[model samples]
Target: MDAAAEPVRRSPPWRDLLAPGLATLVCLAILLALGTWQLQRKAWKEGVIRQVVERSRIDPPLAPPAAGTWDPAADEFKRVRITGRLLNDRETLVHGLAPGEAPGRALQGYYVLTPLVREDGPPILINRGFVPTELRNPRDRAAGEVAGPVTVTGILRASEERGLFVPAPDPQRGEWFNRDIPGIAAARGLTEVAPYLIEADATPNPGGWPRGGQLRVDLPNNHLQYAFTWYGIALCLVGVFSAYAWKRLREVA
Candidate 1:
């Protein structure tokens, strides 16, 4: 047969690609959605970081929120000043780590969370700071215990959420694995306790037993990296689908 008269090769019908096209579109939509969501997350994380940095740098702390006006979301990381007497006898020891005197080493310690009864509002938990494991006994750090009414300035923090690996608190032994404000309040028989805890500043205690100022505001912002990863996957999927479609078309032609 003459080449001109021979049958003209044509690409596969559109119907043949209906299933794969729909699936590719669905996958592409999902990948793009994930990438967009990560971008939103990145913006949210940046805002959060900015708020923390700005709040931390401000001086002349504000007064604690009055009863019925406390909002954990708004109040967290806020520096507040409170004048109250510490209930040293009823202090709770939460397992923690403190910066050691030497660099590159951490000392195992417990956060000394003592109750401070504010003259204006209900009692609130104050993380007086980290005490060495050996100084767990209140008697050992008697000098650091302020006698008269004291003023504490620190950042307000919300109760921590327990993780799957977090160990349960031993109320009987006064051993706490997490900063569960409610649980600690109930364990210490505290009435009208604040919902949040105050992380005390770096004011030197008398004996320097409990080192304060351990609030770490290092939040990792990797949303941009995650967004790029998702977008990369989407590009790969497009390339693969395009190559497959081109090969099929050439074969049909």
Candidate 2:
């Protein structure tokens, strides 16, 4: 064949990449948006941690909120003092894990939640503390069942939201998974019950079977790591797309 008569070989049409290019652009936008959202979450989480730290630093326990004045958002984590007698007969045990004697170990237990009947006000629930599985029965820890007028100092907490996978509480069987305040009050036939609960301090109990002061304030802050992951993916996508486009253009040139 004569050189001048040879047919020209053209590259694939640019329109062939229209679908992939649009897809890449959409994915990049989504990844970038996700990264930005995570950064906003990081800032929000930092603010929450700061608020908790400040609240923890406040010395001298504040008085418990009165009925009709209770605000979970405002009072959560606030240390408060209450003078009342514990109604141990109506105590509830919620499944939990507490720090064990050995380092880095956790003890499977139940949080002993008892209602405290105030002399002049409605009764309030108190998380007396964690009791090991073996000491779940009140009879096992008889000495800790304090009677008469007594004072309790602890941090106030709001009712917990049920998880999707959590089983419904069996009040009849005395089995509880989450802290459902209203449900517990109803089960115990308690009237004029406070809306919040208290996590007791490390004060010594008679037998010390139910260990107090297990309330943890540490919240995981991993938004920064997630943000970085999303941002990194976006960068990689851009680099890969750019390289592909460059190679395609060279082929066409």
> Clashing residue pairs, candidate 1?
none
lDDT string, candidate 1, 1-253, tens digits: 5566767765456656778878999999999999999999999999998898777655889888875788877788888899999998899999988777799899998999999987788999999999989999989999999878999999989898878998988999988988999999999999889888889999999998678999987679999999999999999999988887887666665
Off by over 4 Å in 2: 1-16
lDDT of 1: 0.89
State residue 37's C-alpha deviation in candidate 2, in Å.
0.9
Worst 10 residues of 2 by lDDT: 2-11
Best by TM-score: 2
Q: What is the lDDT of residue 84 in candidate 1?
A: 94
